[model samples]
Target: MKTLNSYLSETVINMKPSGIRKFFDLAANMEGVISLGVGEPDFVTPWNVREACILSLEQGFTSYTANAGLYELREKISEYLFKRFDLQYDPAEEIIVTVGASQAIDIAFRSIINSGDEVLIIEPCFVSYAPLVTLAGGKPVSVSTFGEEEFKVNPEILEKYITSKTKAIMICTPNNPTGTVLSKKELEAVAQIAKRYDLLVVADEIYAELCYEDEYVSMPSIEGMKERTILISGFSKGFAMTGWRLGYIAADRVFARAMLKVHQYSIMCAPTMAQYAALEALENDEDVLYMRKSYQRRRNYIVQSLNEAGLFCHMPGGAFYAFPSIKSTGLSSEEFAERLLLEEKVAVVPGNVFGQSGEGYIRCSYASSMEQLQEAMKRIKRFVQSL
Candidate 1:
């Protein structure tokens, strides 16, 4: 009889289990748990967007779309990018709708990374980049950023890790876990490094519309970087459409075509109804604005409350999370998270899950209601005092 693990791919065998999953499993079984663990938005998809998707189904638009996604959705995405970021791409040949930004990352890695290539990933980062790079036969090299820096990726950090074998760099802003958004100056610096090294860039800007302080900056918007950058974004974060499972990547025609081939083999197209819903979202900007304002309010409340509770937290410029330092409690991030869940009934993610740079921090998502945020903060304060 074959062993249960015998059939696993070597890469799969070597991969660590997701650090986010264990806490979620514990949170699921506990009664009355107030969870700030997940990075999902609490708002429902705007009625107009949902109605458009239903309309499509009613009109018998359930068939599989083109491998590159529907032409109309792609065109809308192109227009949206131009209007928001001043970035331009030909819809027909430069964009491919994906299952989500998650799939776009996978496709990007598969398309460019050959065996033994190195991909630079900024940490603490979104969890999937390293695993996906490994699956594509590339090594993930992490560059650590600090909370004091607002987790911005510095040029020196990029320069330190880049080598001849480096194939691509993955950057996310506003960043998950830290809620750090890169400034134009920072992005230009990154662009310079990319140009100097002749490196491809995978910019994940799913949280672009959720910025609270300044405007979102895109690597592609910098002069001369658009051709070398693959812009990955989706409606999930901005439009409160996480369940829609729709995303897209925009790049030069050459890279876009290569990604399309991988996308065709893996996921023929993004969900048909989701593509239609996302198209409607692009046409309507008001919904995104409303959600953005709501998240900003939540961000402010959580940051202020955590600071008052003796936990040091930097006010995030974007995204719906606050990464507060828990070092004063004399507990590791994992221990603090575990005790907070068991004793205070509040669920948060341990920062160490993102990378070693995340140690001594815990990520709290404020996507829940204000009342929930208030109660969670009170519990957290009580827990800290007890410690």
Candidate 2:
């Protein structure tokens, strides 16, 4: 019989297990463990949205959808993008419904990258990008963003990393872990660089609706960028519908066709009921506004609590996480996280899980209730004092 080890694809064999998942697995069975490590929203799908899904199922909408997604759902998404972000996309040709934003990222990489192409990723990024790039036979080149700079991508640093072999740059604003939202000026600078190099831009805007300050901006919305940018977003973050597994990519028709081909062979289409629910989410503005306000309240609470606990943290303008420097604890991020879980029954993700530059920091999600945030902060403070 053939050995099981030899049966795996080389890419699958070589990929490292997700760093976030490693600790999460351990935390799962531990009693009384209060976790702030997950990036998902704590809210359930809104009643109206859930009802839409149920209604679809009752109406026998369980069959597979069109490869590009249901035309009605795509139309709703197109209208939503234009109404919210002033961006226009031809739903029939320019959009592909995906399993989630995660799948969109994967399919986009597959569509554009060949073996050995380099993908420029901003550091302290979402954990999946590097491994996914590797799986697509692309090399991931990380450019570190410092907390001192409010985690904005530096144009000079980006310039230094560019080469002829670089196929694309993956940009995530209202970023995971750090919760930093890229400013309009910063995004324009990135656009200029992409324009100069003729590079494709993969802009992940899943957290667009969560911005606490200025309105969210799409890279493709900038002049000269729409054709070159592949925009990835979905209902997951904005609508508190993580379980819906519905996301869509808006790109040039050419790239969209390429991704849809891969998506056809792989996922076929996003879930039918979920797509109907997402259609409702896009048409409803108040649901988005309500969730945004709730997250903002939680954001303020966590930032203040961390500061009071003596962990210096930047106030996040978007997303649901607060990344705080744990240098005061005189421990590496892994050590700090491990000890916190062991001693205080509190769990947060170590920054090192994001990338090497995340060494002395830890990420806490404020998507939980205020009471949980308060308790976690108190436990953290006691743990720090003990250290």
Candidate 3:
């Protein structure tokens, strides 16, 4: 009569559930709750992408693709990368379509991390980074970025966290939670460190298409970085295909070959129809432009509204989230978020869930409709005033 729990993997057991989903689930069960918790886009998948999937199904192309994915899709990805980001990768040797960017990230970790290896994770970052590193038998060392610096990674600070055990560094730009996009100068600072230390970089560029200001800088495009950088991205954020679960990874063939073995065993291939849909998504940039413009408008309104409401939000440069300081209210992030939800019927994620640097802040996604965002702003102002 031994407990079944005794046989469980301690790694999985100790991992906390996603903080984003925690608020999302709570909001789901409540009535009339306006959730700004999740980072999903409000836009529907473009008609062309959806039609491609339908066409694929109609044509009975429903079999498993190569473990690496369809050759045509991989080729299109290579062209899209070069065209959009000035990145170059060999389609046959360096690209692997994944179930999602989440999977792309996981396999990248597994491919490079060894037991007791340390991967420096820049924070406040996506919640999955640390856990995936740990699950891959590596240590996740967090390098904190603060609001004072607008959350951009400072190379001096980043280098301090490295050690003999450090194997790689994980970065998400146009970062989640905090919408700071790293400029080329900022990236070059980091690139210098990586080269000096000979460290690998896992760059999560899922929000590349959503950058608000200047052109997006791809890590691989940094001088001398393509050979050591693993580029992870997908259709989830910019293309509004989250449910389709399509993503891909591009790297030097040496790195890609290692990650492919991990993807091959765990995922086999990304969904057949989804691959076709993503192919269509890459063929056109008009839908992406339309959605990015909408998000930029929302970003402006939300940042302005939050600051006026006394929450002190910095204008995010990319991605659809606004991380505003709730320290003014003298409430812990969790306390503020919980009470705000209960009192005002508005839901947002507590920033501390992302990393310790995020404490005293909260993340509000501006991806909802204008009507909903306007109302959410009003309620948030009222809630702040009440305190």
Candidate 4:
């Protein structure tokens, strides 16, 4: 009989579990532990979107959709993309509904990467990017961005990483861990470099609508990037629809067709009820604005609170996370996080888990209520003083 390790493929054996979820699991067994570790939004899915799903279920709409998804849902996603970002996706051929933005990300990598292709990844970035690129038979090369630059990738530095083997670059704006949003000027530079290199771009814009100080720009909207960009987004963050697991990919026909082939075998289709709910979500921008405003206030509160408590954090222009430096605490990020959770009963993710550049920092999600934030701040302050 073969052992379990013997049966596992090298790729599956090599992948590390997500660091964010690890702390969350530890915090769960403890009572009254206030957590800021997970990236999920705190808000409930809007009532109208939930109602649409319930209605669809009541009407017995329970079957697999066309491999691409419901034509109407795709049509609405196309219209929404055009109106919001000036993107034109041909709903029928250019859009494919996905399980969540996560799956869309995975298949996007798989569709484009040939074995040993190098994918330039901007760090410190989302944890999944490297693992996903590895799974796609590609190597992930880190391109570091600094805190002084507000975590935006500099184009001049980006030029140094390119080689003939580099096939694509993955970008996330309104980024996780650090909440930086790329400006139009930054994107223009990136677009020019990508155009010069003839590389594909996977722009993860899941937090596009959550921008606070500046309006978010879609990468595909930049000149010369339309045909070569694979855009991934979802109803998770902006719509508070995490459990719905509905997302989409918008690419030109060639890439979309290839990705759909993977989706057909791996997922078949997104849930039928979730599609109706997402259709309803597209009709209600008011709900999104409401959540964004609330989050912005919480962002203001947490950033200020963390700084006042002796942690230095830059002003994150978007997303609900506050990436604060813990250097003064004289502890490694893992030591800081583990001690804080055990001592203060406040949970957060260590920054180094995001990438090597993330050492000496921690990511605190302010998506929780003001009450939880208040308590979490107090506990963290006491913990720091004790050390």
Candidate 5:
């Protein structure tokens, strides 16, 4: 008899496990490990949001919703987008709530990507983008941004990666790992390129609410980009509702319909109770703002501490992460991360897992409590000094 692994799809069999989760698993088994590995918020979901879900359950509103998700939740998402980012979409026709932004991303690629088509992905991006593209039977082409550029995507360099096979460009901001938020001008430039190439733009703005610098620029708000841009976001990061697993996609009707078809077959609809919880989250911006402020403070302290310890970290403009260069310690990214965890009981993700361009750094999420962050920093400082 052949091995069970032989029966697995070649695509699934060959895919590498997530690099972020490796450290997370390592830290999980070890006691006294101050882990900054995962990007989840240390904050709990706000009381009112949880209360709304509990209320829904008590009311016995636990049946399946529309395949496109609750219309009211879609409307609230539409309103929130317009109110916060000046982006507009039709609640009934242009949005589909899915099981977190991860699902939104999956369906978006599956709907548009044909076998052998290419999607231009900016690195160091979330690990899922490339794999999802591959699973969709599309090639994920890397358009790497450097630290010297503050990890901001450059349109000229982006255009260099385009070819007849190229079908779409996927971008995230405020970005994961790097925390670099693109300016409106930068987005406009990429918009022009997308329009010129007649390519789709899958904009992952999951961390939009956490932006700390100049105004957050929604890609769909860019002129002529809305029709081509598929906006993926959720309550996971900014709303402190990671476990709620509620996210939505906003796109033109043509794209929305196609993606809805894929989502209906795969997920049916997002969780019914989570929709109620997300509705409450949308109504309560104050809680999200409070969390953002706390993350910003943590960001400031972590960046400062990393620089002081001679790790040469850039001050991230958004998100709750610090990508500090570990090159000075004369260790590879994985070596640095493993040694830091083993020797100092501090856990962080190595940058090389994100992409080749990330080889010299490590990503430290500052979403933990201030006390935890302070202690982690002290341990990190001592480790670096010893190096």
Candidate 6:
């Protein structure tokens, strides 16, 4: 009998499962588990946003939209970008509404990469980046970032990794699993390198709204970058609409055209009701502000608790994750996370799942409720003390 696995695409088979989701799946069904593993907002979609989707259905706006998405939603996205980040994008030609930020990223890779071409990925990064690059027929090259540098990309180290085959670089700000937000100065350094090398940038700014201390800057805001950067963002993180599956990509006409071709044939359009809901999300900022405040509070508490517990954790500038080093405990990230879950019923993702550089650390999301976070921290403190 032929093995069914033999017929699957080798590329798909070779890809690693997401480290964040692996721990999360275990945590989900466990009784009395305090999960700080999944990177999702604890808040539900705001009433008005949900009502808008309901209204759309009531009005019979259920047909597939234009391949790029509803023009109104695209216009709202355009306005939101310009208003928030000072970015200028053409709604008609540049933006494509996607199923989610995940899909937006996947299709962007499909748009620009060819077989054997390399795309530089910053680490520790979202687990999806490497596998998607490979699926798009591009090689995934990692440029390491360290905790000492606050995990910001160092231009010198990045330069050493670039080669003749490098075609693009993928970056996530308010980065997943590590709440590091690149500053304007940091981004400028990266922009200079990309400009000099003429590398296309795939900027995943899905967590843009969650930036703390400093305002988020779009990579395309940099000089000479607008034409070469494909910006991927979505309402999932900021608007707490993960199940809504609404995201979009903004790029130059040349790049947008290529992505549109793939999206057109592969995914005809984003959901009609979700598009209506997204418009409501865009027009209002109150729900976003409320959630950001909650996350910021949790972030501070988690970082302080981790450090006080004798785990070395740095304060993150954005997002809601607290990555603490467990190196002093003399345990690998996976071992520590597994033990913590079983012993304390507290769930955190092992950082090594993000990349090799993350091996000594674990990622703890602060997106849970204050009470849950407080309880998790208490359990973690006891667990560390036991070691």
Model 3 RMSD in angstroms: 0.8
Tell me each candidate's TM-score: 0.99, 0.98, 0.99, 0.98, 0.99, 0.98
Question: In model 6, what lDDT does residue 369 have?
Answer: 84
lDDT of 2 at 12: 88
* lDDT (Cα) of model 3: 0.94
The TM-score obtained by model 5 is: 0.99
Clash pairs, model 3 backbone = none
Q: Mind giving the per-residue lDDT tens digits that candidate 4 earns over 1-387?
A: 888799888898888898888898999999989999878899889889999999999999999899989999999999999999999999999999999999999999999999999999998889999999999999999998887787888999999999999999999998988998999999898889999989999999999989988767999999889898999999999999999998999999999999999999999999999999999999876889989999999999998989889999899989889999999999999999999999889999999988988888999999999999999999988888887
The sequence of per-residue lDDT tens digits that candidate 5 reaches over residues 1-387 is 899989999999899999988899999999999989888999999999999999999999999999999999999999999999998899999999999999999999999999999999999989999999999999999999998888989788999999999999999999998999999899999999999999999999999999997888899999999999999999999999999898999999999999999999999999999999999999976888788888998899999999999999888989888999988899999999999999999999999999888999999999998999999999999999998
Cα-based lDDT at residue 270, candidate 3:
93
For candidate 3, what is the TM-score?
A: 0.99
lDDT (tens digit, per residue) of candidate 6 on 167-283:
998899988878899888888888998989999999999999998887788899988889989999999998999999999999999999999999999999999999999999999
1-387 in candidate 2: lDDT tens per residue?
A: 899998989888877888888779879979988899989999888888999999999999999999999999899988988988889999999999999999999999999999999999998999999998998889999989998887889999999999989989999988987999998899999999998998999999999989998888888889999999999999888889898898999999999999999999999888999999888877765777888899999999889888888899999989999999998889999999989998898989999989887879999998898888888888998998887
Per-candidate local distance difference test: 0.92, 0.91, 0.94, 0.92, 0.94, 0.92
> What local lDDT does model 4 show for residue 182?
92
Q: What's the CA error at residue 114 for candidate 6, in Å?
A: 0.7
Looking at model 6, report the run of 10 residues with the lowest lDDT sum: 15-24
